[model samples]
Target: MSLCQPRPAESGYGSETSLRRHGSMLSLTSAASALSSTSTSSFKKGHRLREKLAEMETFRDILCRQVDTLQKYFDSCADAVSKDEFQRDRVEDDDDDFPTSARPDGEYNHNNNGSKEKLFSPASPKGINGIDFKGEAITFKATTAGILSTLSHCIELMVKREDSWQKRLDKELEKRRKVEDAYKSAVDELKKKSHYGGPDYEEGPNSLINEEEFFDAVEAALDRQDKIEEQSEKVRKPRLTLASPSDAYSTIGTHRFANKVEETVQNHMAYSIQEVGGDANWYYGDLKLLKVYRREVEENGIVLDPLKATHAVKGVTGHEVCHYFWDTAVRLDWETTIENFHVVEKLSDNAIIVYQTHKRVWPASQRDVLYLSAIRMIPPRNENEPDTWLVCNFSVDHDDAPPTNRCVRAKINVAMICQTLVSPPEGDKEISRDNIMCKINYIANVNPGGWAPASVLRAVAKREYPKFLKRFTSYVQEKTAGKPILF
Candidate 1:
């Protein structure tokens, strides 16, 4: 019966039966203790989980009740409005047929007497949550507006939850960082405690398990929140349709245009230095002293040679010349090769999609183009470099207007970039508009869609390009003669 004290027979030399009985009793007692401990721990864990779930359910139920109450109020208000409007209309209809002269002066409209009194009665049926919306004529529009306003409040709550999504992520990251610090500290403490006893001897039972479960729950919640936000973003993307050239190019931002300008300028500069006049096939124009270059490509036995023309004009800055070229109003005065030209769409202040018809060049048929033209002002790379201006015109496709039956659509892709290398002031002379000399570089590469003989195309480029440049600069000079210089 004395559990803690040793048995007298166990201390002395005992019989086999006594020893076996003592061992069996001790084993049974140990098993019972372990089972009781396990059952108590399981019960506590189940109770904690129930508490957490109940708390979440309570919050959800409160939100649902509020929404239900609001819906009931909206329905009651809508019904009240409809009833009032019907009664008012009936009274008005009955009044219309009654003779005006037959009625006595200061007489009440007896037809609507009972209806009007009932309509404005103070006592009415209570709406949801005991709110009375009686006698007040809330129209259909007003009732709908009220419902939407209430809905917006609910949506706003959800929005507030996610508006700080970035902050939530940062907080999660911070928690992870702190967890890592704690883990490192724990490991260091474990190392020190190892010398005294085992690591588990310092920390209580189930401490490690609880820490792991907490971190795992945090990670799962974070992942769920991240996916929710990502889906919300995808759902929130704007659906944009391109209705015009303006919309088409607007889909591409300004940064994209600036990049295109830079690329065109670089290509133009590379050609100016290395490729222009390097080949023997280049032909010179005697009339305007212009150099015209051509390169040929044989595709399906048809020669497609893109042409490039370069010329220098005096007494004008590249800014003025480019500005003159961009002026669509004055283009008819100088660009003689164009039979008709009109801007179909304005994409931006500096960009447009134009429909243009080039005049027939002897043997080659008249060609048209739907192209986007954009102009840009490239600032100096540093204080020492002179400012440059660039104009790029490239073919674009449009659904609203297609190639006409009269002229073939020419596939043209060209960027005509003009650079102004402002000459240094002549020894103490100020930099004035008249004295500033700028070198103009004009490059054009056009591919007339159908097979036009290479010889004819090259000849047209040699003659017409020079004439085009001379007339353009001359027009610029005439227009800007007495006007202030624009840079």
Candidate 2:
């Protein structure tokens, strides 16, 4: 009985030790189970994050492509605007036929003989390149505005989409960061508790994503988008403004008037000085010295008998001759044929609009003329050549001098060009009228509105032109004999 009592204490001690070991094993098992669950969850979360990143990448690519397309469209719109500006400039440059103020009040069409014939009142809008300029301009402006508006809308939509995408990316990044932190903690716990030193205890290469690289890519995309938006803004705002039709027309009309005057002056200066007509149409003149030629020209169903006369006179300066020819004050003094002469308008210091009634030729109606008379000093083409003076007269319509029924309206285009040659007294001496010689080239294209017998017209021209030149030269010499020379 004493031996059995000693065994009971030993059995109790062993039972207690076994209970403690079991408790420790259970604790280790629970920890292992929790680690496994955490790893699985982390893996799933990582997969979801990868998928989200892939979707973001795809969306970024699409957005980038869309931006490129929009950029190309904007470039095309800019090109179109540039082309429209060029076309506008070309149209303005081509407006050289006549100014609106100077345009004849009739439509002109080319006749079979290539002369312009009046058809109807010329008040209708003209076309350029078969397109109405006013309508084209309006359409161009509307189209440009539409293009700009569409671009602005597209840009706004793109920006909104980008902002939405960015917000989603930010949320996904936050969730991924939390998941990564939990996974890292789980891995550390597993490593600390692991008994068998295995590769699974360390962080795996594919477990953690490179967040820095992804963030950089997103930042780059956003930067590019911002740049695109800036460019779009620049394109939307244009520096050059389109002018209204009225302003454009007014500017073009002024240029046209100036251009016409310059062109006419150049044409008159370039006309051949030698006799133009053949022997039959030569009229009476000495070809060697004083050459006078006459020719008949038809224009707009009207006859124009143009006369060309070239002569050289001693004891007269070119300035004196041109001055007397151009001055309205002295016009009637030498122009014996002019009955009533008055200035309709003074265009400038060197230009005036004159209304003149010429003495009626026998068997012909009295002719009244309204014309613009201008005087200019032409610089010599070469330094060695002397300066030339010119007086030009062309028919022009004036509001103040409307065509009257008192006399037949005559159209005349006349030019008297003269050059002076001075012979200096062997040394440097003041030049006198005797030393100066004026070379004159006169062209007169007269259109008598009313019909007269051809024979009478020719005979009258033959007698009148010579007499006019002689009287004009003589009067100029008499007037400028003691006057200061004008160069």
Question: What does candidate 2's lDDT look like per residue over 1-487, in tens digits?
Answer: 1212211111122244444544543443344344334434444454343443343343344345434533453454455445546655655565454453332757653222211111111211111112222332333343344334334444555676799899999999999999999999997555334412343322123312133322333334335544654565445432222212222211212322456556667888787444464557555577455777777666654567778898898888777788778776656566656779889876656667899897643223467999987777777789899977777888988888888865789888899988899888657777877788999999998888764444445655776687678767866776666666655
- The segments of candidate 1 whose C-alpha lies over 4 angstroms from its true place after superposition are 1-266, 269-277, 284-289, 301-303, 361-363, 424-429
Candidate 1, clashing residue pairs?
Answer: none
lDDT of 1 by residue, 106-193 (tens): 6654456677567644433344224212211222223333334334444554565577787899999999999999999997555433
- Candidate with top TM-score is 2
* lDDT on C-alpha atoms for all candidate structures: 0.56, 0.59
How high a TM-score does candidate 2 get? 0.45
Q: Measured by TM-score, how close is model 1 to the native structure?
A: 0.44
Q: Which stretches of candidate 2 lie over 4 Å from their true place?
A: 1-257, 272-281, 287-289, 298-302
Q: What is the lDDT of residue 453 in candidate 1?
A: 45
| Model 2 pairs whose backbones collide | none
